[model samples]
Target: MTTPSQDRPTPQDRPTPQDRLTPDELRTLFLFEALSPEQLDWLAERGRVERREAGEVVYREGEPATCFFILLSGALSLNRVLHGDDVEVTRTDQRGVYSGATRAYLGDRVEQLYPHTLRAVSDAEFFVLPADEFAYAVRTWFPMALHLLEGLFFGTRAANAIVNERERLLALASLSAGLTHELNNPAAAALRATAGLRGRVTGMRHKLAMIADGRLDGAGLHRLVALQDDAVQRAATGVSMTAMETADAEDTVSDWLDERGLAGAWDLAPSLVAAGIGVSWLADAARTVGAEHFEAAVRWITYTIDTELMMGEIDDSVERISELVGAARQYSQLDRTPLQIVDVHDLLDATLTMLQARIPDGVRVVREYDRDLPSIPAYGAELNQVWTNLIVNALDAMPDGGTLTLRTWREDDRLMVEIADTGVGIAKDVRPRIFEPFFTTKQVGEGTGLGLDISYRIVVNKHHGDLRVTSRPGDTRFQVCLPIEQTAEATETAESGETTEAGGAAEASEDG
Candidate 1:
């Protein structure tokens, strides 16, 4: 046995290529303890012992996975590049712990890049075997196990992709139905207001002809046209009033019109009041056209005011339609790139707008956003889905009516978006399993149970973020924390859902 230096080794002291591990030394490692003598001999011949200094990288992630490694001594760390940071997943000094080229058996079927970066936390020694040789040995010696692993691996990939797509479709269908219902109301209102507007215009034209007849002079007509401009301005900037206040104003206008002996005074009072027309304006009309034609002049002014109000209604209806369409586009991210810098508040607002029709009238929605928080790099569309799921869950939690709050803030190197609800919270026993696929408290057919699960994957696996939940009766909050920027390889496995998890040990079984 040779004693290695405690300090970093010099060139003269480094292990030579001729220094190889014998079958007996290879068998000392637990990984090869159960191998037959001939198998150990084969490994002893092909595998080499390599030494690395503290902080030295064995292999960087995304590089060609050329060798399989089994630690023989010293501590090592397994890290994956996530959101522009090297996030350490596992650190251990345990001998026989192996990593790198673990999937070489798949060969050309999959990209054979190192899944993680391995670094020596302390001076380390590893038994290394070329990827091709390791693949051959595994295929020849453990064909059955390898076959089972391949089946499970490929099966999960297919299932996750299909189920993920299905989940999105279900959400899309629901949003589409809700958006259609919301659009129909304003569209119908605009249509009705448009028809009424046409009639009002024709009436105004007939009234104009009567007022302009030999009974009235150009000066009177000019005064009425000038007053029409003021009416339009007042109608455009009309102030909203409580029901009682509005009724009182209408009564006052009605009394003034009745005192003047005008017919349909009650009918015209509301429109006149809404247009800010009062007894003073009516008195002016009486002076300008005299008592006999005063009724015609007042009716003409009423017609003008009514047309302005109708036009205001049509303008509001069109604006409502435009707002709904904009919200739908934001929620769908239909024209935006899949991954981009996104404002969490904008996404929240879009989601709320899309689900507005489904929200109970008794429930109140509140936004507590940190306007100073910067945008984050993410899969915008998938993140929108996450917001939708959390929002839907919050709404469902409060069937009896409560507050749904969306809050955002910056937390250290990450940005957090919190969705909180005042409702019957998740039970202690059920909380742990909420993110498990197909696990749900909702009744059968009411939920797919994949809502939270998919959300977790989107926030965690794709964006390299953290998702947590805290709950108690009347207060349940789901918070998602994401990095502000993404590394070049941040989304390498985003589409595949094959990202690694941070954990304690590598486990005994390779597939585990």
Candidate 2:
């Protein structure tokens, strides 16, 4: 735990603040060397020299950034708070290096909090200017330069947001098309089955009328209705049969029907056999209804069984459609809180569902999720985009079909998700540039080259996490590490940035 500020020594605990630099003394630093004599004088009057002991924080992140500090002597490091732990991002001993309220000139348009913590690695000296004064001097000294800088900063951000949106829409369109294809299969099956079911129901009603036309008494008709119920039950729990076994069963039923002089025996035999009805069941039917009523009773029962079987198919197909629709909603995170504690496995499963049509029959997906891993606070829809990009890249990697594996586990205070592909791996020369913006290996018109770059920003910049890759022929993996707990930096990034959806490159090892 950090000691409260009051418990730490103040400047009074050490030597007094050093005298301000003279104009010539300020010009000795590289940063001020380009300044005019008048500009140097202006800085010398405003900037003060401050000393710090090693291991002391100059300013904590998320504090109201109040000053700008330029190195004079000694070494220092920059650290970002991640999951309550200070993780060092950089260290420098170069004179004139600066830190602190670097973006103060942006004014109230953006929050003025320090983006990272600054710490002295050794007893250090820095020239400090109050943040407001620094902002005034920078704007006054170079108004045009400041305007250009502002344009560049905000322009890049705006461009990224626009492109990120385009990327997301493209992905959504592709997935929606795939979903349409997947939904069509079951929907078509249900449509055809419904029509067939209506016909079977009508045929059963006509057959029933024939059986009860006084040729069979109420008691016999009641017996036939009981037989119909049994047939329907059998159809529900139909037996699985091999080709030869099915052929033999159908032949036996057909022979029995033919021997009784029933027409369409061959056609009727298959449906009866499919419902596990055989010669023994036929004997019982004949005994209950007698010779004259046996044929009509058998036809009605067959139609009843067939109709029940068709309804089962329709039920299964409709249920499948419902499941697909549910998975689509889950994948899109529609109706979900943008930021919430979420199960990683659910996100993975939903991505897989959305990509089901795009995944080739030859490419198999294997999930290796550690269910015990704690849920994490995250932007659900954004993470789904990360999954989509990674999985799509994996599919592209294995054009001829291979295993695509998704694995998740807990590593320290972070959760790690790995997407692996068994395909021609990423080239060694290209690996370093994989996450650079607009760096793609795909041919023109095929990729945007921002998939991994956006993924890196979301995972690293936004989540205060890490993304890493390792590759070899037939074995390539991209691992995304996310903090399981919300850190101060995560909160700051959330407050500062727009949440954007991610997309994948069409080529393997994403160039888009």
Off by over 4 Å in 2: 1-30, 373-377, 456-468, 482-512
The lDDT of model 1 is: 0.81
Residue-wise lDDT of candidate 2 within 1-512, one digit each (tens)? 11122332223322232668888888888767878877776677667899899999998877998988888899988787544456776788888888787777889977787767889999999988888877877787778978987887687678767887888899989999999998999999999999999999889778767745677788988898899889988998899999999999999999989999999999899889989999999998899889888888888888988888889989999999999998898888888887788888998998899899999999988989898998899888888999999999999999999999999988888899999999999999999888877779999988898888888777776777778899999999999989888765465564223212122100111111
Give the per-residue lDDT digits (tens) of candidate 1, residues 132-248: 878877777888978986877687777767877898899999999999999999999999999988988898888767755667777866776776777778777886888898899
TM-score of each: 0.79, 0.84
Top lDDT: which candidate number? 2
Q: What is the lDDT of every predicted structure here?
A: 0.81, 0.82
Measured by TM-score, how close is model 1 to the native structure?
0.79
Query: Which regions of candidate 1 fall more than 4 Å away from where they truly are?
Result: 1-100, 114-130, 339-341, 375-378, 427-438, 491-493, 499-512
